[model samples]
Target: MVSKQAGVDYTETFSPVVKMTTIRTLISIVVKQGWKIYQLDVNNAFLHGDLHEEVYMDAPQGLAVASSRLVCKLKKSLYGLKQASRQWYDKLTEALHSRGFEHSVEDYSLFYKKSANSSVYVAVYVDDIVLTGTNLVEINNLKSFLHDTFKIKDLGQLHYFLGFELLYREDGVLISQRKFTTELLKEFECLSYTAVTAPLECNLKLQAAEGPLTDPTHYRKLVGKLNFLTHTRMDIAYSVQHLSQFMQDPREPHLKATIHVLRYLKNDPILGIFISNVPDFNLRAYCDSDWAACPDTRKSVSGYIVMLGDSPISWKSKKQATVSLSSAEAEYRSIRMVVGELIWLRRILIEFNVPCDTLTHVYCDSQAAVHIARNPVFHERTKHIEVDCHFVRNSLQDGSITLPCFHY
Candidate 1:
C-alpha cells in the first residue's frame, strides 16, 4: 500500500513572500504616474515543477487499481507537497533570468528589466503576479510569453489584488478591504456591536502575561486575521500588534481589545489609504515612540508613517526590542528604524529609474531626539546610541537627508 500525508510547513522549505511595503510602494507609483497595472494568475502553478524525490501516494478511491498493489509515484510537484512552492520558485526564477530580468537585491521576490527607453517590473506572491511598466507593448508581449509557457489566467487591470480592492477615480485610487473586514466581523459576531471612534483606547496598555486566560484557539485566530487587516488599515496596526503579542497566552482582555478593533472597523470598513495622482511624489516620514509603554516589561512602542507625496505607503507599529530609559532614547530608536526604511525605498526608486532631486525630509515631535541626530556631541546619554547617531549624521553630511529645524 502507498503512504501519503496532506501537507507540512512549506515555510520551512521556502521563503519567497514579498514585503507588503514593496507591494504598496509599487501600486503607489503605478497610480501616481497613471501607468498600466495588470494581474496574472498561473493556473496550477505548482504542477509545472518536476518532482525531485520519489514520493508514492495511494491510488484514488475511483482509480482502477489492480489488487490494490499499484502506488502512484509523483512526477510533478503537487498542490499539497511541502516542496511545491520552492520547486515552482526555482523554475520561475530560471525562466525570468533567461529572459534578462535581474532579481532585486533589496527584495528577492521583485524582478526588473530595462532597455534603453523601456522598463518592466514584476512582483510575485506565490501564484499571483502583479506587473507594471512604462511600455504597454512590452507588457503584453511578456504576458503572452508567460501565458504560452505556464497557461496563465490574465486578470485584466488591477482592480482587486490579493485581499485589497482598488477603486479608481480621476484624482486617486482608494485601496480597501471592506469585503474581507465585513466577513471577519460577521465570523466573530462583532458586526452587531456599536461602532467605535478608535481601534484602541488611549489608556489601553497590553501586557503579555496578565488577564485571565481565554480560548487560546479563538484568540490566536482573531489576532492572526486582524494582523492581515493591518495591510490596508494602518489605524488598527498598533492595536493589532498589541493583541498579537499575547497570542501565546491570550487573556480575556486581549480578546476584548481585538473586539474593540472590529468595532472600529465597523465605523468605516470602506475607508483605506488613498494614492493620489499628484505629480509631486516626494518622500517624507514621521516617527514617534511611547517610552516604557508596556506594563509587563516596560518596553517602549515605536511607530512610524512613510508617505509618498501625501498618501501613506508604509507604516509600522510594534513594541521595541529593548527598553529605553528616557523618552528621547525611545524616539531616537524610532528615528533610526524609519530612516532605514527611507534609505531602502530611495534605493528602490533609483533602481526603477525614478528621479529624486530634493532631500528626503524626516520629522519627529521630540526636539531632543532631533537635536541628537543633527549634532555629534557625545555625552554619557548619547554614547549608547552611537551607531544610530553616526548613521543619521553621515546621511546628513552627505546631503541625502535633512532634519528641518521647523518642518514645513
Candidate 2:
C-alpha cells in the first residue's frame, strides 16, 4: 500500500510505451522464422533499480527507525515514485548495451543482435519481456544472463502478456484476450448479465451532456479499464471512445451506457482479433466517417481499420477536431489519417524482413472522396480544406497509396 502524499508527489508520470505496430512486427517475424517465443518476469522489477532522486517515506506502524527523527530514504525505486519507470528503463538499457545488444531506432524498447546465420530479439514492456530468436541455445543463454542479474522467471513458452492470450500453432501464433475479458466481467459483477450482440445500438448516439452520475469515480474507473481492454478488442474501440468523452461530468445515462458495454462483454466474452497464418504480405486499409455524428458539437466521427494480409492489426475511432462541411470531406480526412498508419506499418514490416510492395491499397466507401483523391483538380468545394488534407492526393501522385472506391 502506498502512503498518502501530503501534496503532489509527481508532476508528470507518463511512461513511454511500445507501439502496437512494433509488437505486431515482432510477432510476425517470430511466425515467419518458426521460432519459439519465451516470456520472462522480472520479480519486483521496480525494486531492482537504484533510485537517483531523494525520496523519503514515513516508517511503517510496527517498524521504527533507530534514529528518533530519521525518515526512510529510498535506495531503490518504489512502485508509486515518479521516476521509477524511467530509472528502470535506463538501468536495463545500459546493461543490455554492455552485452552487445543494439536498440532499434524506431522502437526504443526493442533490442536485438544479429549475425549472418542467427538473430535474437527482445521486446520489453515494463517488467515483462518477450524473447524471440532463431536458436533455442541463444534464447536459453540470454535467459540465464537475465536471471543472474535479476530475479527472472522463465514461463516456459509465451502464453500471455499484457492481457493477451497467445496460442502457438503449427501454422502461426494466435493472439486473444478472452481470459482477461472473463476477469473483467467478474470484477464488475457483470458475469451473468444479459448480453447484446453489438457493443452499441445502431441508432444510439452518445453526447457529452447527459444526466448526473450517482458515482463519478466509479464511472471513470470503468471507462479507464475498458480503454485498456481495447488492446485486443477492436469491436469495443468505437463504444469506448464514445463513452470516454463523459469522464469530466458523467451522468447516470452515461454510466448506463458504459454498463451496457459491460453487459455486452459478458455474453461474447471470447470474441477478439485472431491473427492467422496467411502468407500474403499485402497491406490494406479501410477508412469511414459519420458526418456530424456528435450531437453536442456537430463534429464528425472518423474511424479506420488496417489489415496485413488476413489479420486486422490496427484500428481507431475518434471525433474529428474540426467540423467538416460534408460527408465527403470527412471521409477524405479519415482516409488520409489511415494512410499514415499504413505507411508506418509498412516500414516496421520491412524492418522485420517482410517483403511489402511499394504501393498500399486504401479502400473508401465514399465515391466523392475517391474522386477527390484521384483527381488533382481542386475546385471551390475543396479549397476551404487545410493543405494537409491533400496528403491523400500527394500519396496518390507519388505512387505510395492506391485509393480505390469501395463499398463498405
Candidate 3:
C-alpha cells in the first residue's frame, strides 16, 4: 500500500523502530510503581492519519461512481505511503499534547504527565498504545478521552503486543514470546530436528565459500524473521548476526547453521527472557568478543548483555567493522559500543524518574581490555586503534563508567 502512494523513488524511507529494551523498561517501571497498564488498538490505524502529499489512488472497482472522472485523492494517510507512519505519529502527538501530555525528548513515542495527586504515562508504537498511571480512575478517564478523539478499541489488559506475551499475575507480570517461537520452529520445519544445548557451536565457523542456497530468498526471509526474535531471545542474537553476514550470498552451510539454530529452538520453544519483580535496579553490563571469529573476513564478534537487577533487558552480538590485532582490542571496541547504549539508557531512565545510581558498572572478561579502559598510556600495541576507543578511557577517568571485572 505504501509503494503505491509513496513513489519508489522516495529516499530516506526508514523510520525508527521501538526497541524491545524500551518496551521492557516501560513495563518494569509500571510494575515497580504498582500501576495498571491498559492496552488499546486503533482500528484501521492508517486511515486515521492525514496525508500531506498529493497522492492519487484508483477508485474501487464496484464503488466507483460513473460521474467520477478523477482518481481518489488521499486526504488521510493510507498504509503503503512512505510518510504514513510519520503522519500518524504527528497526529497522535498533536492530540496527546493538546490533552496535556509531555513527550520525552529522548524518545518521541514516550509521553508522561505528573501532578501532585496523579501521574499518567503513554507510549505509542505506530498504532498500539500502552497506558499506565498510578490512579485507576485517571487511567480510565484518559482512555475515555482518547476514545472520544480517536475512537480507539480498548484491549483491556495487554495479553500481547509486538510479539511479547504479557500475562498479569498477582505476584507480578510475566512476559514471553512462546507462541512466536513455536510458529518459527514450525515454519522452518525444525519441529522434528534434534535439539542442541547452544544456539551455535563455539568452534563452528561459517564462510561464504559454500555453494549458493537452492532458495536464497527463503534463507534471507528466515534470517530476517529470526532477527526480530532476537529482541526477546538473546541466546540467538550471535547466531543470527553470524548468519546475516551472508545474506547477499548465503551458502548451504550457512543455511544448515541457520537451521541448526531452529533445531535448538525446537527443544523449548517457550524459552524467552523473563522479567520478574526484582527489587535491585542496579545497572550492570557484561561484554565479550570472539577474536577473529568470522571465517571470510576474520573480523571479531562482540556480544554483550545489560541486566537490571536479575532480569536481562538488553543484549547484542555483531561483527566488528575493523580487524582488531588482539582480543583486548576487540573487547575494548565492544565495550565502547555497550557503553554508548548504557549512556543513552541512563539518560532515558533519569527522565522517567528512575533512580539509576551514580556509577554505571561495565563488566569485561578480558583484564587487558579493562587495563586499556583504565590506563591513559596508549602503548605501541594499542596505538593503532581509532580515537573513539580512547573515549572509554576518558569516560573511566571522568568517573562516567566504572569498569569492574565480571565473569560471564
| Tens digit per residue, CA lDDT, model 2, 177-223 | 78878888888888778888878877888766667667799999989
TM-score of each: 0.93, 0.91, 0.92
lDDT: which candidate is best?
A: 1
Q: Which sections of candidate 1 miss by over 4 Å?
A: 1-12, 64-70, 386-389, 406-408
* Per-residue C-alpha lDDT of model 1 across residues 271-383, encoded as one tens digit per residue: 88998888766899898898998899899999999998988989999889887878998988888888888999998877767777789998888888888888878987788
How many backbone clashes can be found in candidate 1? 0
TM-score of 1: 0.93
Give the alpha-carbon lDDT of every model: 0.85, 0.80, 0.81
Clashing residue pairs in candidate 2, if any?
A: 211-251
Q: Point out the worst 10-residue segment of candidate 1 by lDDT.
A: 3-12
lDDT of 3 by residue, 1-408 (tens): 224423542334444445568888878777766767889998777677766667777676787576766577788877777777777777788888887899777777788887887778888888899888786877888888888988899998877998988777775677778898889888888887889888877788887888777889989999998998887788889899989999998889888888888887877777777666756667778888999998778899998998777777789998999999998899999999899888888877876677876688998889999988888886887999999878887778877789977765
For candidate 2, report its TM-score: 0.91
State the local distance difference test value for candidate 1.
0.85
